[model samples]
Target chain A: MNAAVEIDVKSEAEAFLIAEARLLDAGRFDEWLALFAEDGFYWVPAAPGQSDPLNHLSILYEDKSVLGMRVRRLGHPRVYSAQPAPRTAHLVGNVTAAPGAEPGVDCEVRSTVMMAEYRPGQAADRRLWAGQQTHKLRRTPEGWRIVLKRVDLIDCDAVHGILAVPI
Target chain B: MPDSIAPDALRRLVLPDRVHRSLYTDPAIFDLEMTRIFGRCWLFLAHESQIRAPGDFVRARLGREDVIVVRARDGRIRALVNRCTHRGAQVCQAERGNTAGFACPYHAWTFGLDGALNSVPHRQSLPPDFDLKDPRLALAAVPRVESYRGFVFGSLAPGGESLVEHLGPIAAVIDNVVDRAPDGEIEQAGGVARQEYRGNWKLHHENANDTLHPGFVHESSVSAARGDPRDYAAPAYDGHQTHTQMLSNGFGVREWQSLSLTGFPAGHSYMGGFYRGGVLSPDRDDPVWREYRARLVARHGEEKTARVLGEDRFNNLLYPNVSINAQYQQIRVVTPLAVDRTRVTAFCFRLKGAPEALFHRAVRFLTNLSSPASMILSDDIEIFERVQGGLANSEPEWLDQSRGLGADRTEAGGRTVSAGLSELPHRAQYAAWLRYMTAAA
Candidate 1:
């Protein structure tokens, strides 16, 4: 592809990701939920290439109800972990699109992101969480919906503090 | 003997039914524990299945010391200190991976899977007599490394009971975990969740078998899971018809007193209590339970199956580190970072050859009730932190574990109490802790 054509595709993917990150950062969870297709999957693998969520585990492998509960938990006033609420800032970059396996399917995009979270009462420590994310996008009437969002955390296996909200 | 603890200091800290506050808040005591207790105990390394392939390794912590457990090419597993002897840099930084050999990031000092320093940069610069083949110069292996049914344990101490002997009556609990699988083996599955708690490590150890707190501390969770209409009725233990329901309902003094406590040697103990009302019961007709029951029957026959499955154990505290809840496929390890801070790693296992639903149920149980994010765990953390905070005060000399003391029954190699409300296990743990710490001194 020519440089201009590549830039155009990159801009489009970057815009979609920016909007998604904004919704989450702003705590507009319902708006963020609208960005997923009906059969979309949100996964944070327990380990890399964990194919079966049945036999293996995922930090998160939520289909609708589980995701809904997670979003609900973020707003749970009595959630002791969320008493002061968790603050997060997302820095997303390096969006690259690759050809989809099947024809007519939306392309796959990969990006690197760093999320810094601060939770009061838990600790004074502010952690800079970085990860590589893969998004399987599909063009829908609602612009672009995420078919799959996979997050690979740098410290997934290490001892973790409270993960009160989705990363 | 300043580096060594004084006997009077140790005595003042531990008592029959209560431990002095210093045991939880004193820096000196914490240091002593690192050398005396954790240094000598057969600390859990990693399950053998974690490093099934050659060069596969997992990093584990025995107290403050970090060690790497690697499977060698010849199929022997070795647990060695992660520190590179040349420059004292970590040889392997990754949490886990398969590698031909470990090369230190600092100087590229390479070590074999057996932890022998195989190569160093610019070997020509070294003196002719400088020997690299000496075993002493190799990554210092744990003094003792052994496995019981794939669960690996390491001890820095040179002498002690073997892994099997140390496990005592609790060995059956480990067998129960693996034997639940049709293949009679279980592997660490679904990954592990590590979390830190701002409390003494022993608090988590004690809380594992402290069945009384779950009903009260986890009342919110119990209420949530029990749902709305019955949530009000759930608080009363007497109303629940089944064991599971009553457990979730909240344990009153009378009900808690009815459970059994078995205290084994080496500080291990278990609290036996049925889940009231069967709320936590896996469906009998469920394919997973059917397979598990059949395997148990085949292995131990029908009568033994009843004894295994029907026998209720709320928590099995495995001395200084592990706590196994076999019924739930939950294993929690307490790593003491400091006198006031603890790191708990919880692993939920998948029973090999069992139905998918079985594993999912275990995941639910862990995430909903035991996870750091779980309301129950957070509440317990709050209480533990509060205890740690309260113990920091100068006034209180001892924390009580005196409940049901006079009623404890002496058993072979351990003590057992007929009633669940007994604090025999707590006392037993303190007793064992004193013995281990004092004897080592």
Candidate 2:
């Protein structure tokens, strides 16, 4: 691809990512939900490239139903952990694209994210969640939708305080 | 020298029926526990099956001390400190693996699976009087290490009761866990879920067998599962009431009074009661459950199978460390990090020959209801942290373990049980905690 075309592609991908982050920041979960493909996977590996979710564990390996359940849980006020509700600001950076595996499907884009969360009750109370994320984007009729969203947390094995929302 | 605790102050922290708040909240007491209790008690290490192969090894923490358990070429499992004797650099960094020998990243000092000093670079440069073959240069082994039914445990105390004797009546509890599999053994199958709670480690143990808190503290979960329209409710405690109102009103005074407690020596205990009529699988028609039931019955016989499967055990506290809930395939180990911080590692086990559905059910139950991400667990964690924070206040003299105090029925063994909502387990644990903390090292 030409340098100009590559720059345009990169900018477009960055815009898509920024929009997704905005949706999450605004607590527009349902709107963000629509940005994924029908068979898209939302995976947060216990370790990077965790192959099997069965024998090995994952922070999250949600399909449609599981994702739906989590979204529904977020709306439940009785979720004590969500009493005050966690506020998150997603900082996305360093977007890069790789070769596409197939035609009409753009290659994967990698980025780093730092999520700062606050809860009223926790001691040393604030957490700055850091992780590297990769998104496989496919050119849909409307625009680029996430086919796969993988999050690799820096402290995935460390005892987690509470994760009320999707990381 | 002034920082050292006087023996009298330590004695006053523990009583027969209750313990002072300092035991759980004081840093000094925590340090002493590391040296007195954790240092002396036989702590659960790792299962032998975890290192089935000749070269397999697993690294674990025994009371703030890091040790590596490796299967030697001769098939014997050896537990050795992870630290290299030369410069104290960790020999193995990985959580688990199969290796011929461990090499220190810092100096290339290598040790055999048995922790014998196998090689060191530049032996000629060493002093002529240096004795490389001396045992002191080898990796330090835990003072006492033993295995029962594939479960390995290590104790820093040089002399104590054998692992089996220390386990006492609780030995049956371990047997129940391994015997569930038709092959007459259990292996760690599904990967472990390690989570830390910012509260004292003992809180996890106390809460494990506290059947009374579930219905109340877990109201949100129970309501969500029931598909109720009402919002989730947090458990409320009425100081005037007989006991904490953590559980729903379902467990009335009469029912709480009638529950049985089986107390074994060394602080092990089991509380028996069915909370919500054991959970039924979502897919009742699945052939796996049927085959599992059949196999259980075949191996244990109808009476024993009913006892094992139907009996409700809120928590079987294996004092000092492990807690096994067979019905749920949940085993939790508490590793104390500080007075106010504990790392609780929960492992979900799979029956060796059971159906896949059985394992699936266990995963669903554990992850949905008990994992750190669960609403119920978060609530419990909140309360624990609150309690840990509150104990700093000088108001309360002692935390109550007086509930159902006089109601304990002494059985043939060292075990004792109280009503479903009784605090017998907590009291039993404190008693053992006191004994261990006070015993001469």
Candidate 3:
């Protein structure tokens, strides 16, 4: 690929990541869900070097269906964890991309995301979650849909308090 | 017991069918519990499979004392106090690994797998009277360490009940878990998922066998799952088991009351299987279940396999710390961190000789139920913290555990059976708590 085309791929990936962060920040989980392909998954591994979500435990390993349940639960009125829904600001940076190995794929986009979550109360709970995200993109006629989005938190193996909102 | 907490005063905190809120809120009481209850109890440490080979070790907590559970070269498992005997620095820092010996970071005081002081940085600098062979110089070993069916437990108290006596009839629960394995063995698979909650450790145990709270506490996930429009008919559908498991929590009042709840005097308790229709149902006739059943039958024969597979119980709480779910092959170990904080570490087991897919399912179950981000446990933890927050007020000095009190009946064994929604488990826990708190020091 020429320099202009390479620059275009990088810019496109950066734009997609920024837009996705905005959707999460705005609590537009439905729109975020739409960004995932039908066969796509969202994984947050518990261990740093965890490879297999099937055989290993993870903080989260949700396919679209499970992620749908999560989204629904987040919206449910009785969801106590989200009673005072946590406000999150996802800051994306350090963008890098590589061409997909398989056919019918665009590129694999990698970035660093630091999500600042604040649960409102007299004694508010504020947490800064920093993680590396790997998003495999597929260039469809409509747009780039995510095939896999993996987040490896800095404290992947640490004993975590309730993660009310996604990082 | 601590000087601040008298035996009589501690005894008063736990009555026949209620306990004082201070038991959950007072830091002094929490300190007493670390010694009187946790110090004396046979707390579940680690599974044998985790330290199968010599030199393999895992870090564990016995009350507030950190210890290294290591298998020595001689094939003996020892729980060594992680502190260096010299300067009290932690000897081992890693969570789990294979190490020949532990070297203190502060001073290179090496301790063997058996916690024997093997070497000092500079022996020549020590006084002539400083004996290296002195027992005081070695890392302290837990007073007693024992294993039952690959489940290792350590007791800080020097001597009390034998491992069998401590387990009482609950030993059968461990047997049921091991016997479910096709090759009559199970290994700890998948990594551990640790979650911290702002509540007393006892809250986790009390809620483990409480059937009535699920409908109210997990209404969010249950209702969401009920409203889910996604198709679940696909064979081997991914994540459907979690959906069904969440739905199981929506059991009706009558249905929750119908299931059996049994509590032992030792504080151990369990509830009869409630997942009757879901993919998590032990009797589900699916490919994975069918394959697992075949493997069990191959080893134990038809009748034995039927007996093994037929046995179904959930959240088998073994007193102060551990809760086991044999059917799902998971265990959650509770560790008290402070008066109002606790940590729970969950691990999944792979049934030997069974299909790998079954283990994968177990992994999924562990994640969905215990992970930090779990939809179910997040609610439970929130309630625990809320309960702690509510207990901060002194208006209601006592909390009730009297549900199904008069209705409970004693069965053939030492077990007390009651309706599924009964708070007998909590009462039984406090009964044991009172006994431990007031016992002669």
Candidate 4:
């Protein structure tokens, strides 16, 4: 590819990731769910450098449909864990992009993210989650959609408390 | 600590049907439990499969002690206190690894996999009376390390009931789990996912067999799953089992009451399985089920396979620290970290000869039920923390365990059986707790 094309892809990927983080922080889960391809995956592995989501345990490995259910559950009035919804600030930076591996794909984006979460009226429940994310983008007729998004937490194996929202 | 809290006073705190809130809030009582209960009980450690080869090790916790459960070169498994005898520094720093010996980073005091003190740097500088070969200079070994059906357990107490005796009739549940394996063996697969909650350790065990709480506590997950029409449609999605598992919590009063809840003498108990619908159902005729059934039948024949797969006990609580779901090939090990905090680590097992997909499904089961991101488990954890917060108040000193006190009946082999919604397991647990707490040490 030409240098101009590479620069465009890199800039586009960075913009896409920044927008995605904003959607999560804004609690627009339904709109966030629309950013995925039909068979897109959202994985949060329990261990760093974990490769197998099928044979190995992950904190979460949800396909698009499962993500739909999660979005619905977060909106439920009786959701005890989210009774007082959590407020999150997602900071994304250090982004880079490379061409996608397969055909009909755009590029692979990698970015570092630090998410701060605080539940209302529970100051002690505040948490700061830091991780690196790999988003595989595919160019669809509509626009660029995420083919796979994997989050690798710095403290992936740590004994965690309740993590109700997406990181 | 046990003396600090009088036996009679402790006994009074646990009546026939209710327990004092202090049991959940008092640090002194927690300390006593660390000695009497956790100190003496046969706590589940790493499985043999995790450290199958020589020199393989996994770090585990025995109450407050950090232990390394390792397989020695001589084919023997040993649980050694990870602390170095030289300066009380930890000998092993990694969670798990394959190493011939552990060398303390502080002073290079080396110890073998069998926990024998191998060598120490600057030996000549030590006093002449310092003997490297002396057993006292080596890392301390847990008094008793035993294995039943490849499940390793360690007890800190010098003398107590054997592992089998501690398990009692609950051993049958272990047998049923291993028997379901097509190759007659199961190995630990998938990594462990851990979650900590701000609640007493007893809360996990108390909630394990309580059937009534699911519909109330996990109502959000259940209702959300019910609201998803695609989950019940003819063409199922990839997360069909995940959705169905959550929906299973919506089991009604009649369905819950029809199941059996049995408690054994040794504070161990198991509740009958309730996932009898959708893809979570054992009788599902999917291709994966067909393949698994064929593999099991190949090993145990038709009738035996039927008997093995037919045993559907869920949440088999082995007293103080372990809960097993044989049907899902999952185990959740609970560790008490403080008076008001506990940690649970969940692992999945793969049947040796079963299809690879079966193990994948088991991994999914572990994630859905035990992962910190679990919709079902987060609710349970929220309730646990809320209970801890509520109990901090001085009022309502007693927590009820009387739901099924009079309904319990003793059966053959000294097992206490009750209705599915019964709190009989809590009573049985406290019965064993009082026995351990008040006994002559």
Candidate 5:
């Protein structure tokens, strides 16, 4: 195994992730877009330890353009499913930076997050979603930008009802 | 009728044009269904790929009875009731796994992969005449287990008819899915989306082949995707309009064109959205789809391949519980929990030996269709729940189903064909239900 990563390398990545979760929780999606590198991906694997996104099914698998479309749709006034949006509170912990896998990457931060959501409706149902998250960041000219963010949910194997908003 | 349900009243509840609400809301009927319908039918066990190796297993429930399908040391597949002989506790808890044998955590009772009793807590504690060889002392195997083209099925009933015969013409639905793979094999090897709906299970069965609700229920999602809202301001038509103009037009998919419904014996049917067209494919320009078509042409030749790939069907139902969408590479099944609760699982199948993108497309369909997270399917789920809630009003005793009746023409092998927005599939299902309820098992 590789030696423990430097604290400087680890802290910046940790801060970026915590701030990213805050952005999502606050619904500041416009600023959230700026945090990503030109080439970035958001993915949620369907199976445990699923390596091939191309061959396997995932709850959400999107490249940059698809992500743009999804963000646009989430903002659409007429989008029925996201009408009265569900709000999420994220608890992100265990942030640690791993050696970069990309040729020109800054660092990869691996963290675990427990998200509880409340969707506004007659029933006002509450759901708890817990998952492991990984973010690959690149040092852009402006600052560090996300190259990838992957969420591996514990119950991704179980059937989920409508996922109205982004996870 | 309000006090108690006589066995004879089951037939009266299912009138040609409508069915009574009690059929959905009654706890007694649900219990009877567990025995008369689900117990006798050839229920799906496991895909052959899921249990490819010896000691491989997948656990599923047949009705409320927990069952496990396992591949044994002898390379044979078998299903056994999961209740341990010692105390009726479930023997296995994991959904799917590989193990040489099952060890019950309750009492340490172990059984071979084929469900033969292997060990007990202490031999000396047993009575002198106690025999380990009794089948009851071991895990009880299903009365009959059969597989057709690698699709395993098991029946709780002792014996009556063969599995293939039970499937009848609906077996073609399975053939359609497997044959679409350039190679003759398909894998439901991808992930399954399991979801629960707070509605009666029959709602999904009826909705699986429903061509009536797409334009109304899914209009908003369609507008977001296709940017067309031609009929958005139109007054909603009153309930019960037969021979109505095609509502599927607003959905903006080729498969949502002129409807074609064909019903078969044993409640099997396939519903196509178009009378005639190329298959509902939007990826003619994609390199992945092109390569996939070429492989099909090479395997099934030009004419037959085009014929095979050109049907514009939406969904195909296989009798009591399963629904297959060959176009989307999905096999949907339901497990009813209570009179008002049901769980739906959609199995996504990938075509073997095709380009990886082909599998990716299949995954997209399986993800986009059905399940709670689906942009398209949640519309139906909401309505199903509404129906379950509405039945409590007690004003209308029957829900209307009299669409495209008297227009069906009988075809070969007890199959019937009908035109746009036919309710013949629902009739066919109830016909099978009637037979099962009254039959002398």
Candidate 6:
């Protein structure tokens, strides 16, 4: 009852990440939320290479509760900032996996990505947003889940415009 | 519409109760403000902690000039224009770092931490008549730079009010923030939350003291925090609460009545709505608050510290650029990029000698209340952007600021007192704006 199954960890991981990006880019937040482990972390460090979020400030640091609340706000019609939502796109690649930090998981997925965001922004009427991202993922029994996703912006120190949406 | 900014024409844009929309969207008006307002006023640079070590430097901007705020080898802080005297190229490109000195990338002309010309590359190329001691030869220093406690500020005008004189009543907020620290000092903690908005810089400046829209704009957040976020039928907080919570609004005949809007001379104002006994109560078993309060009692004694700790000031706008929340240990700086674009950077401070818990709590408050994820900030930015968009149109030529006109009463100490939700802050700011816009250069 067993067929030869060739499991390419990198390919699966890449597919998982591409699917995750698709969910986000399409504004399918609820589906994206399902891709996170129960205690997953969505962190955008305030300082470059910042280690801890509790002690230091973060642009976005959310546990399940906070992430849920933000998602809820994003969906609310009266969410003023969301009336005309900031649109974004993600391009994920360089996928690699290592042993998972959790006991009963396959491995952690690491990747390099470039994302562009726009909210009617312009310097000379040019719409743009750019950043690099790192994601730490784990493979569960059913599907891959994100444990930690870190976004490092080129202008991390510069004043930001409407990071209200997920980066 | 005449192109000239004559005294009468400038004054007409700003009335006692309303302001012309062009004032918020005109590039000409923005350029004039760069000269008459920002150039003449004391603008915040960086906290002392930013440049605590000798040779540590952080870049800053005043009006549109790029500046480097550095702590010199002698431990004195200095601000120097980034323009190279040789070819006018920027001498330093980094935002902040520890560096021995800066050397222009274009040419090797170097300057010391104190901004003196340390050396020039290929000095033999220069003529023998060059006078190194000439004031114009070295880095062009800002006309006036001063520090109060740990906050540093700089002014571009050759002659104007002293930093302290310019601070006026707004000075008290800084003092209280530093004085409340158990060690009588505070240090910048965590990183800054840098937010950019598509709106006039003045909108963020005025929003600090504009307390009327919270109930309407932040309605979603209130319900989310307390009830179901999707509870569309839920009414806004309406500044009402249970009997116990009513006391928090202060003398709560009406929530608005509980707040006292005060305006001061030279364009400064505050919205006082902080509950009595302060946002942090000493009675709580919270370890950080307990320890913090004990230290205050030990140094300042019980009775005095109580009033100091129980200070009721909520939002303090230090005219032109900075908004401070001493109670929550926050300092927000607003930078104007263009007529309709601005950036706001916020920092949370740690009260020295307090537990790390206090630092965490401060960070938590900032995250929930002002971080980019915050609905409060989002709503405010949305409104600001909408206002900016609306002002770009000519249909509504004037922004109605007559919310509480003819209701201001002169109080002592150059203060104009008004009831709740009055347009006192806008009035106060416009008065100063007109004076500066019309003053002789």
The residue-by-residue lDDT of candidate 2 on B208-270, one tens digit each, is 667677656665544444442322242211110111111232354466556666666588888
lDDT of 5 by residue, A1-167 (tens): 33444877778777887788798888777678778776777788878888976566677765554455456546666555555677989888998887788786768889999888886764266898898998888888798887888999998877676676656
State the lDDT of candidate 6 residue by residue for B1-441, as single tens digits. Answer: 223588899988999889999889999998888888887889999999889999999888888889999999999898999999889999988888999988988888788887778777777888997766666778998878899889999999888779899888788889888878888888887877878888899998777766677666665555444443323243221111111121222222356655778888788888775454342322344455778788888888999787777676767888788888887688888889899889887888998887776777667656655567665687788889888877778887998888888988888877888876788889998988898888886
Docking class of 5: acceptable
Interface RMSD of each: 5.8, 7.3, 1.2, 1.2, 7.4, 4.9
lDDT of 3 by residue, A3-67 (tens): 88888999999999999999999998888999999888889999987888899999998888778
**Residue-wise C-alpha lDDT for candidate 1, range B252-314, written one tens digit per residue:** 667666667888768888877655435555534545578767766777788866766765676
State in Å the error of residue B182, model 4: 1.6
Rank list by DockQ: 3, 4, 6, 5, 2, 1
Question: Model 2, DockQ value?
Answer: 0.24
Query: What would the TM-score be for candidate 6 when compared with the true structure?
Result: 0.88
Q: If you superpose only chain B onto the true chain B, what TM-score does each candidate give?
A: 0.91, 0.89, 0.97, 0.97, 0.90, 0.91
> Against the unseen true structure, what C-alpha lDDT does each candidate score?
0.74, 0.73, 0.88, 0.88, 0.74, 0.75
Better of 1 and 3 by DockQ: 3
DockQ of 3: 0.80
**Weakest 10 consecutive residues of candidate 1 chain B by summed lDDT:** B237-246
RMSD of each: 6.1, 6.4, 1.5, 1.7, 6.8, 5.1
Query: What TM-score should be assigned to candidate 4?
Result: 0.96
- The DockQ-based CAPRI class assigned to model 3 is medium
Colliding pairs, model 2? A159-B196, B216-B246, B216-B247, B256-B419, B261-B416, B261-B417, B263-B414, B263-B415, B263-B416
Itemize residue pairs with steric clashes in candidate 5: A159-B194, A161-B372, A161-B373, A162-B372, A162-B373, A163-B373
The candidate that achieves the highest DockQ relative to the unseen native structure: 3
Predicted candidate 6, C-alpha RMSD? 5.1
Task: For each candidate, report its DockQ versus the true two-chain complex.
Answer: 0.20, 0.24, 0.80, 0.77, 0.27, 0.42
Which candidate has the highest TM-score of all?
Answer: 3
The backbone clash count of each candidate, in order, is 16, 9, 0, 0, 6, 2
Which stretches in model 3 have alpha-carbon errors above 4 Å?
A: B236-239, B277-279
TM-score of each: 0.80, 0.84, 0.97, 0.96, 0.86, 0.88
